[model samples]
Target: MGTSWSARIVDAPPDSAMAIEAVLNRVIAQMSNWEADSAISRFNAAPVGKWMALPADMMTVLRAGLYMARLSGGAFDPAVGRLVARWGFGPDGLTGLSAAPNHPAPWTAIEVEGDRARRTADVTLDFSGIAKGFAVDAVAMALHDLGATHFLVEIGGELRGQGVKPDLQPWWVDVEAPPGLFLPTLRIALCGLSVATSGDYRNFREVDGTRLSHSIDPKTGAPIANDVASVTVLHESAMLADAWATAIMILGQDRGMALATRQGIAACLMQRTASGGQEYMTPALAAMLE
Candidate 1:
């Protein structure tokens, strides 16, 4: 996770902050693309057709990533590692050329069995879409283990919260809307759910005078050419929300809204309109506002 993280706990012990920091850093060591020795990096560096043993948690995330790829119909994929590197959003950002590869890999080529996974093809794996959310979850678990019943953990703006403050109020969070969206902010009462927001306003590059989003449409092996301003997802698991948010954003406004409705997903999608922006929300998310 190449972002800032924060943990706020009610009645947290003196050493709880340091403990939570250590826990988050440990997660980074396991999944960080920037770390050459990270478990995920090792898996990526492994030759094609070679099985790499992974930790149980990493395997769980790999399974989840595959599930999301299927659910989104390839709109969101972890196998876009090569595209990520080419678009200058990977471990070596900015210096890399921003051009799509001729033979980029797809997520379907990966094989997973128990705590081991291998690529049947020459596909590289990138976990940036979901790793931060996993780190947030880990921090929340660490806080719970430290006897913190009321806590909120956020990594790169994806967050999870449990329990109410001592004053009996829920942990309130302000979800940021992209610059062009009509609504600049949406507030939520966090009790036992995670929130993840994905947008093109941030984490993108202006490639050759064309603003290219870091989010690549695996189907085309190129940056998605959609007018979606931003999308936010709420779920019990931040990792799920994180991956889904990215997928739904790539699907564009109409398709994303339809999928969110058909699946009963609590999602908010904003589309870039001529004047400013328009938005949509699933029924569950509407209820949250009320």
Candidate 2:
């Protein structure tokens, strides 16, 4: 919600843009951590051990986040919201944080029942990793409801594509190599798939003379230190792709690639190298390119 969004739909009504923006605005109201009045912010600011009613969409994303936290063995935790705030990535906007606390809360602190949720401990939830992908899917659904048969929805680089262009060509997205690394723009076809990328090259800081990623590993409650430049995942659901990309980014090169292979997911990971950069792809991702 802090970033921009764009959508392109074939033979769309002129008001399609407005419709997409309205949908995005709804998503922002529901889940934006930057917005003080957002549902997530309200939940985060709520007192501990209080059950709060959440919208269906918010509940869905929360469930997905919890699933990812378990699937990644705490590597991708929603309970790290306080860690994000302490590290100056939260709404407070205080930069140059000297230190960070360990995961402020555990996922187990959360209890969800139907449309109501509560924290057993001093837990906070953040959806920074998965909200945009969910918003993209929301836009896709909105467009379809508006009678769009072919479209591409993107928010902050996360993308979802359905059908094809009027010319019958699939939506093409250009994947750039990480900054300070020289490589050609890799064009990826986005047809019947959703794609998301988690990169360490952007949104980072220099702590103790070492460049560190802004993405905190929930297991450590610290900025990630790894050779991974970026990990891109392609899935049928953009929200799942978004969560998987963050998980793989936190897992680093070897383990991430191993999980990608074991799970049989489409993932392309690039790691930084002294010479330049090296690419790693799971069998599914390689097959997609082929």
Candidate 3:
């Protein structure tokens, strides 16, 4: 939550507004790496045999991430931390390699024990998939507790909306496709719903003529090279939506859509064409667009 976050509530009381701001501030403090004592920073520093009891916010995110990994057949894995770190996405700098380490995936080697998690493999846990969405949900709950009935919450690109504006309409959101592509905007009415988007556009580096994305495939321990460029998931919980979006992206277009359909999750995938054009959602995902 060190990144930007916004909320809109209609006709909120002054005290409620202040409480909402306080909640956002707390989220930023807990999630930001700039703060030395942030939960994420502490988790990163935690060593083996040291059982760290995660806060409720971080616990919710880890649980959601694990659930998504199971749901996606380990396609969406938080155990790619070592690979992420080697790529210079973590607190450490890059390993000067064009690709990730050629090791087996780490998710299968990690273990979760109640509020404490451990990794037997030489990997760390990167919660980037679910942290933003969890923060959004947490802040939204805080606002709701402060007596704000209708509002929208967003952390980074993940979003959650509840009830409606005073005018009696659900919060509307526009889903954008990746760059250098043309596609119709997805208009969603968020009524007690959460949505999350995961894409390769913003987080990628180029080595030679090939482009490598930050999101890794746990099975291969490598960056995913697929036709799909982005995936958006809509679900009851923001954390689940966020993790699922990343998992779907890792699973690639065909298998990703199949998994989504099997799980009855609404998903949208934006694909890049060889001609530099864009293809819209898959049939299963397009059905959810309506």
Q: Give the per-residue lDDT digits (tens) of candidate 2, residues 1-290.
A: 66788888889966798888888888889998888898988998889889999998999999999998877777778777877777777877656665655434377788899999998777688898999889888889888888998999889999999999889999988888888667666678898899999998767767678877878877677778887888899999999999999989998988887987998889988888899988888999889888
Ranking by TM-score: 2, 1, 3
* TM-score of model 2 (CA atoms): 0.94
For each candidate, give its TM-score against the true structure.
0.94, 0.94, 0.88
Error of 1 at 185 (Å): 2.4
**Models sorted by lDDT, best on top:** 2, 1, 3
Q: How far is candidate 1 from the true structure (C-alpha RMSD, Å)?
A: 1.8
lDDT of 2: 0.85
Q: After superposition, how far is residue 221 of candidate 3 from its true place, in Å?
A: 2.1
- RMSD for each model, in Å, please? 1.8, 1.7, 2.6
The residue-by-residue lDDT of candidate 1 on 77-131, one tens digit each, is 8888988887778888767565565653379889998778998876788888888
**For all candidates, what are the clash counts?**
0, 0, 0
lDDT of 3 by residue, 1-290 (tens): 43677788776656765776676666555555545688756765676546677766666666777777777888887767777766666655566656664546566655668877665545566777777887778778887777788889887889999999888978999997788768877889898989999998888888887888888887776678986788998888898888888988998888988888877788888888877656545455567566
TM-score of candidate 3 relative to the true fold: 0.88
